[model samples]
Target: MHEAVLGIEHPGAYSSATAGTDTTVELWCNDHCDLLHVGGSEAESVVAHVEDAVGVRERIAEGDERLLITDACLKEHGDDPIEATLAEHDCLLVPPLRYAEGRKWCRVLALDAGNLTAFYRDVSAEFPVVVDSKREVASVRADRPLLTLDSALPDLSPRQHEALLTAVEMGYYRIPRDATTAEVAGKLGVERRTFEEHLRRAENKVVAGLAQYL
Candidate 1:
């Protein structure tokens, strides 16, 4: 497998409003539509800017995090050359696009390394795509049996990783629970339920991954 990363500026309302700010926007796409999580001290301001700019009326809030919608139609206007190039080459997106400072960063995992050159060519021709870096993942040899124990490590999102690490250091998992979920959440600047939910999900992934080989 090969991992290709590209960074490009977005002319959309969300990224434009967040540029040079502490606002963070994490984006995932489903059926070619965007699902956005906008969070930070300036989250509300960012949301307002996007809503006003795009004339979107829908909003969904999850604890301290807010979900906002983006105009998928904007991509057709050459805003999302990365996604378009991936579709053309049938490449898989390993990670969702990350937005910061008005730029969209994406990492894709491709089965055929040769696809990257074609994909890059198309994107560069169509949009102002910046090639951040590219590297090949060393494939495991079929003759050597690899241990499954390493799979015990959880596949955590950035937020989940932070929550888990904080809980552990604060002795949240210790006897009698030294740290309350609220306290931990406060320390992380998120809601208590949000912290607990992320922690539970992380624990579940770790347990399931470990138990599979047992």
Candidate 2:
């Protein structure tokens, strides 16, 4: 799976917002870091939606359905307990990690809508503080360029085009945890790493080509 952008120290303690309802939640997991890894099949779509908002909550997918894991939540909780709560909600947890070694921060992946992170107030400072750095959410790279990629060729290039098209076909952006990169790449006769590189390069080219818009 791809890593989200690493923000400040801990992303949990930050105040969060949840759309939809208390049962199915979608919220922003944005933080202070600049680099972000969007690994899910719908990472692109998620990023696109995230761009409309301040953060990306999580994702969900199914076999060939490309189910959209709609509904995210921004909370004031930590990763583990929140994830555990999500599990209680029938959302599978991907992996969990402690980010900075302060024993209070980490990041993990789960079905987007199923994410239930914990939050605590950072009161050690002068005033109240909210944090969500570990969520690995990334703001749209406004610096992305779109000029290099030919509008005609946007649909070309074996590697890049194939990768993007495949993701779309699989509804990676739809959500609900569809097929994984390995799953998609395997069917396409390419390694997941190769596919990812193609996608990364394709994204860079597109960003470069579209830089003027920003």
RMSD of each: 8.4, 17.0
Task: Give the per-residue lDDT digits (tens) of candidate 2, residues 69-187.
Answer: 22333222224344444355443323222222112222333334223232222221322323443343333245742212222232223356668778778876676858787877887
Among these predictions, the greatest TM-score belongs to 1
What C-alpha lDDT does candidate 2 achieve relative to the native structure?
0.39
Q: What local distance difference test score does each model get? A: 0.68, 0.39
Writing each residue's lDDT as its tens digit, candidate 1 over 84-153 gives 6788898876645666666666676677888877777776676567776787767555764221222236
TM-score of 2: 0.28
